[model samples]
Target chain A: MKIRTLALATAAGVALATALPVAASAQDAIYVPLFTYRTGAFAGSGIPIANGMSDYLNMLNERDGGIGGVKLLIEECETGYDTKKGVECYEQVKGKNPVITSPYSTGITLQLIPKAAVDKIPMLSMAYGLSASADGNIFPWIFNPPATYWDGASVFIKHVADKEGGLDKLKGKKIGLIHLDAPFGKEPITLLEKLAKDYGFELKLYPVAAAEMQNQSALWLGVRRDRPDWIYLQGWGAMNPTAVKEAAKVNFPMEKLVGVWWAGGDDDARAGADQAKGYKSLSFHAAGAEFPVIKDIQKFVVEKGKSQVDKAKVGENLYNRGVYNSMLIAEAIRNAQKITGKKAVTGEDVRRGMESLEISEARLKELGMEGFAAPVKISCSDHNGHHKVYVASWDGQKWTKGSDWMEPMKDKVRPLLEEAAKDYADKNAGWPKRTEACDKAS
Target chain B: MDILYKIFIDPFMQMGAAPDLLVQALWEGLVGGVLYALIALGFVLIFKASGVFNFAQGIMMVFAALTLVGLYEWMARHGVPAPAAIALVLTIGVMYVLAVSIEKFVLRPLVNQPDIILFMATFGLTFVLVGLGELIFGGEPKQMITEQLWLPKGSIDMKILGGLVSLQKIDIAAAVIASAMVAGLAVFFQSTRIGRALRAVADDHQAALSVGISLNQIWVIVWFTAGIVALATGIMWGARSDVSFALEIIALKALPVLILGGFTSIPGAIVGGLIIGVGEKLGEFYWGPLLGGGIESWLAYFIALAFLLFRPQGLFGEKIIERI
Candidate 1:
């Protein structure tokens, strides 16, 4: 009986191993791995993004038969928003030879920065990684497109200045920054401090520990006592709603408070409900599913029940943000196909594609995303376009565009970005200089 | 002279100038303390009875809250009548089932295990509950059923010391409810047959068994009682923010309370919670600026460490006189 059982187990193991690879190799597809957190504290913010990223790529497969006739094999590895788990996920998924990696957390992105070049895999951090990575001339493998955190801060200061009639009026006015006490949250401090000195405004920082994200009564008490004229919040996940609620508790004017894009989820605003009305946050992409591309996603992915997203939330802000992210992926793949003249391209090919990537107004309209986001034009020297972003305000229920597209202060931001990039290389001994050539196509 | 003035004199001067802010901070601290005390109350109940450091208490709080919200949403979606009340009752029933299962599956087989073994088991239990809760509730933060439960909304602003101080109505309700629950638990422990049996078990396992008390029954009851406390803490805290796994981190704050208060004393939990909460708030409000403003996270632990150095057994922990 023991001999028979051992032979049966061996046979089953052999059969399983033989069947798995056949299924994996059945289609020649471009592998894309998303380091996502579907469980843990950050899941509230992460779920929609995961759903959005997966759904868009899946929709492409379903509706368009994948980008440029090659299927995109999208896979997700749960990280729970921990940097250690993120690295483990990267190691686990690296063996698959993925065309690109998108580790959504800034912490994860920072960890993968030194590894991406060694592994020859390009990382897309979207709008949330190291601001200095925007200078592709220094850091070639990492990409944080559209706008960097410093760009967001510059625009935020610009918005506050605009609200006060002019930048000259900002002198002596107190500006408080309520940020999560993490690298991502602190990314904007230097830029804001620079702008503060330039504008002659008083800058005060209120850092919230990650553990104490939900508890901010003392922080809000400080806000109440200091009575800063403007408050900028760089909070994420559970911190945003609690901050909004606590700000209301102290009778702080909701209109005077602004948040970064990460803090502007529907759930974040809805937590405060009517009390959060007039609360504003910055956004590069448009909200709502009125766009034609979103309609296609609904038609192909959500309606067919292939999506993990709530059917009602098909066109929400973060979901659309995901669509935009995947759009970048799809566009990069298409550009790579055009550049390398190969239906299937490697990560190096994708890097070159990203360098030369251009999303003109006409191209956006052609892709059924007209007016959805600013026109993006990436080149060899600049990975991030430093694109303009608008402020979206909560009107007791949903978000509405509250301001015109405001450009980031690139004139001031560029010099600082170069200096920081140079400083970053200086800090790390033997940091490899960018060896990749500037593509003339870019 | 400047450093000394900044440390001692500046904070007091600021407090004197903004007396209303001081009052506001005090009220906030008190409310926060009450909630922390409630969480510590769960730990004290289980520790006093089972002598196991139940590291799973925090996840249990998140699980209980998730169960309540998940059940309510399920009921409402299925068109159940009075979904909120029915869901609350069902959640209580679920907690009872959880208590029994934990006692049967986790504790029954390990009846004679070492305290360290049982503590490690709870560490394992924490992960089990986290995975289970995530599987069931899908890990998204849900808004508490505050409107459905008829919890008070909005705040009341009062003029005092020539300025306005705002107090949230829900916080007031939480304070009152916490006090009533603590009082009820006190009465139960001090004046009931089963509660006496529980105390007997807490005193000595063999002695209680010899006196016709069942350790198994006592554990189930104590765990169930702790479950109810967890539910209350979950609701009040969730109403303040939203129901999510993130609330699990706040439960770690109770560890310092347990350290400052005795592991076995109920009143110590409340007093310790108040001290930590109020102390951290005042520290953060007055002195946090000098330290760059995120001191509330570590201030409670620091306060507990100070107490550990001065009173090793805690404010109300029984003195352990071991014979060599």
Candidate 2:
């Protein structure tokens, strides 16, 4: 009889924990689920972003007493950069009424795309995801806020054209692409091929095997042989620096080399700084000690001893960018609450808010993130609100802006986005029909 | 005739046009070869003494480096300065004690088992270490305490032929330390009494036992020595990149080295590592474009496979005489 009583009590406790929260009205609290990889091969990049995401949530709580007086609760589940683990984390956390998920990985985002539609939860991949998800009409659930890989590539090529003084100047030049052999690295291929056809530039492709980033002797040797006028590097982790070192060995001028944002970070620069002088790359967010968001982070998170990782890496580029990622989510939640008059909004409500987000300059200034990113306005037709990107060059020590913001050729990109998204929808049946909020009226 | 000239002769002619580039490629290949040799040496030591391939060697390299960083962090958390943190890291060598205990408890009884069984057991051990490592020390990559360890940063550029050849200070240090360690290991095995016992046991375990040499003592000593080599390699490689699981795959490069060098010969490992390293570098330079580059991935394995056709027993391994 005593044993029966203990078992009954344990069941009652679990029931109470689940039932007690739903009893409260929508204004009680706002819970956001965070999926991150704080351990494994990619932890060098993951830890900083996870820390920044958590700190921004904490800042919202401390500064504003919560969004609309509803406290923010964040649950962090470790994925270790494994796609299977990331899916498991999503399933475990979806029950908590998480309005949106920022997976911070392209591979994880790809796995969760089908689930996002089934669960009616918005998956906000700020920078990396299915590049085709930029077409909101097809991938209504997956939102890439600033830009996709295609946008990044086109913006980079535009910078090249401007540098050569005109698009015609690029007619006969050779351009080489050295990329990691993964979905993440293959993202810009279609757009690059299109650009190659239109601009009449010779395109050479080089593939780097996964986890073999540190030994890129052959890729650089090709650079020596073909001697491409410009080299585009799509790499991650140690591959970035290894490529830089090999290029140095082949006497490939760093100024002519361009890396994607993932390849252009403090870790990559630190590895081959002296040898990689004058290397240029794309930048979506601002870097260095100059940004106000960085200063606030140093004062609030680092000073209070609540740093997510080492205090020394508090203001690093990736860490601050992570903070920006979290801020974007938190603001979207606020916007949703304002429109719905429900402090604790549902996943559907958050999706609507994500569709209508307008991160204006004034909002950035208020959040102490001025100049970190341009105004990002999302709509149903375009999930990637910020198509603008700038080119930045590494000057041995730090990154400096090398060119003004350039936009991708939407006329060339939009058709490809639709085709890719349609193919994805065909493969996974039962995707929700997109709301025609931003479509041109017939 | 024209195709042959373009394929072989013209490239050599171009080498005259760009002798500096050829020399630079060779130098980079040499540095890569040295690091591979260091990893291969660690494998040879463990296999020679115990007759069990320690598949956990790579993770152990990562673990040892992580422990040093963890100790340094722990010291700093308690208000210790940088120099004191260095002293604290040295004390972190107790991980080897725990490692030796694991060998005694987990592996000692499994002795005399089939080689495949022993290999499977080591695979299980690798998983346990990977899990325990993450549990004890969080999974984030930590900067190797280079300043504390007094390793220099940056590289020295030298003009060779017509091109500029550059070598990192850390790579040079790694090459020098690896040579010294291998030399010391050779002397220890050849000149010391315990080393002779180790050799005797490696030759014939039952005979060594009959002659009064304790197999347990030799196994313990060899594992302990391997632990030291792992620690040294861990620090040097971690300083080059950050200490993380990504470095574990670099340890697998030693497998091809083992295949080429013979699993049982120390000298074979050194020579095999150098050959694979230099060959991959040269293949990447001259032949990579034909396949779109990034040939370093499978080049080492192919080289070892081709070499096996001629020297199936490995360069330095004793030929086995099997009775039909």
Candidate 3:
């Protein structure tokens, strides 16, 4: 009789534990699930972004009560940047009626693409994902904004051409690509290969596997032998720092090597100490804590000791990236409330807001982020705005703006994006067609 | 004919053309091999005594490094004088405590168990150390205190053979330190009283226990020694790259070294490390492009696999002679 009573008590405890979260989520709030990673090998890159994303939303809740008088219930599910864990996080949070999800990893973003359409939740990959998802006709539920990997590649080639005087000077030049052998690193190859052919340059390819990221003697040895005139690095996490160090070891001119934006973390360049002075990387938004919005975050959230961020790390590149990501989420939520005439909106409502999202120069000024980033305008057909981006150079201590804004060659990019999107849809046997009306059309 | 020439003649011709690059590759490989041997030494120390594979050796290295860096950072924040030196001493203490605790809590209770069970326990220990290290140090990569430890920096660039070859001063320090540690350990194992006791325990755990040797004590000593070797490997590798959990992946590279050199032989580890390291670098440099590059990741394994087919008992491994 006692054993039975104990078993009944244990069952009741488990039930209560499971039931309490559902009751708490029933409050009148916008449920936004953030699939953020704060652990694992890539956590060095993931932690700052996690802190920036969460602190911004928390700041909004504390300062303004919430958007449109409804509180924002921001929940973070740690993915450790692992695709399997990311998918599991999606499964766990989908039932909470989340307005949107920001899958920080490209691998996780790919996994969530199919589920987002069926589940009616929008996924904001934010400058990193399947670049082909920029085509909204085939991928209505998925969105990549500011620019795609192809745009970054085009801008890099254009910068190289500019330095050499013109496109015609690129003939007979040898260009090398050192990239991680993952989907994220491989994203730029097709665009680069096309550019190589179009411009008559000899392309050298050097791929590094994820497992061999830290040990890169062979790759650098090859680099020393081939002696490419310019090297474009497409790497992430530990691969970035190791590549920087190896370049220094091989006596490669730091000025000649450039990294994709994902490789532009302060820690990555700092790994080479003084030797990384002239290393350059592409950037969509400005870095550092000088902006007004950052100061406000410091006053509202970080100073209150409710944040995990060290005070010194406030304006770092990845942290600012997180802040920009949250800005998109907040603006989309506000837009959703306005369009639906409701305070607490659903994921479908946010989908419409994202489809018709527009952040103009005037709006950026109003939001205290003037000159922080290029104005983004999302349309019904085009999700990524394909805006201009600039290069940021590491000066041993911090990053400084390296170049003026350069536009992506859309003439070469759009056709390829459309073809890849169509291919993706056709490959999936039961891929859904977009029947939902566009926000502008409605 | 083209394939044969590309395979056999082209690589040698390229080497002849750029003798400086060949010398640079050899130096890099030698440095890499020394680090690999240091990690394998940790494995051999524990496996020789306990007969457990001790899969946690890799994470142990990472954990040891994180602890050193974390303690130093904490002390520096607290305004402690000589923080690096003090932290180094404390980290050695912490490693000792860890060894004693592992021997007591993890190994002692499972005494006389099957070898596979003990091996699984080490796997569990790996997850525990990874979590504990992350919890204490946080998950960001940190700079190794190479300067504070008084290790050298910058490289010695020599202009020779019509080209320049740069050898990092830190890599040179690492090679010297590794050799000293190996020699020290060799003397300890051969000459000391505890070393003889350890050999006795390793020879026959039951017999040693019957002859009044304490199994628990010997296990503690062995683990503590392994911890020291792990700390050394971590510092060297961390200097090469930044100290992060990613360093754990490089630990698996030592496995091929173990297979190529006998698992039970100390000198074999060093020889095998150099062979695998130099072989992989040369292979990846000379012939990797024909196969599209990135072969260094698996070339070491292929070399080890070839060794397994010919000499099942590694280069210096004792030949098993069981009279059935």
> Chain B, TM-score, each prediction?
0.98, 0.93, 0.98
lDDT of 3 by residue, A133-164 (tens): 99999999888998999999999999899889
Model 1 over residues A101-175: C-alpha lDDT tens digits?
Answer: 999999999999988888989889999989998889888888889999999999999999899999999999999
Q: Where does candidate 2 stray beyond 4 Å?
A: A1-28, A244-252, A273-277, A288-302, A395-398, A426-442, B1-23, B66-101, B108-173, B203-210, B307-324
Q: What is the lDDT of residue B280 in candidate 1?
A: 93
Each prediction's DockQ? 0.85, 0.43, 0.76
Shift in Å, residue B59, candidate 3: 1.4
Writing each residue's lDDT as its tens digit, candidate 1 over B35-154 gives 999999999999999888889899889999999999999999999999999989998999999999999999998987898999999998899999999888887889999878888998
Residue pairs with backbone atoms closer than 3 Å in model 1 (clashes): none
**Models ranked on lDDT:** 1, 3, 2
Interface RMSD of each: 0.6, 2.7, 1.0
Best by DockQ: 1
Q: What are the lDDT figures for the candidates, one per model?
A: 0.91, 0.78, 0.90
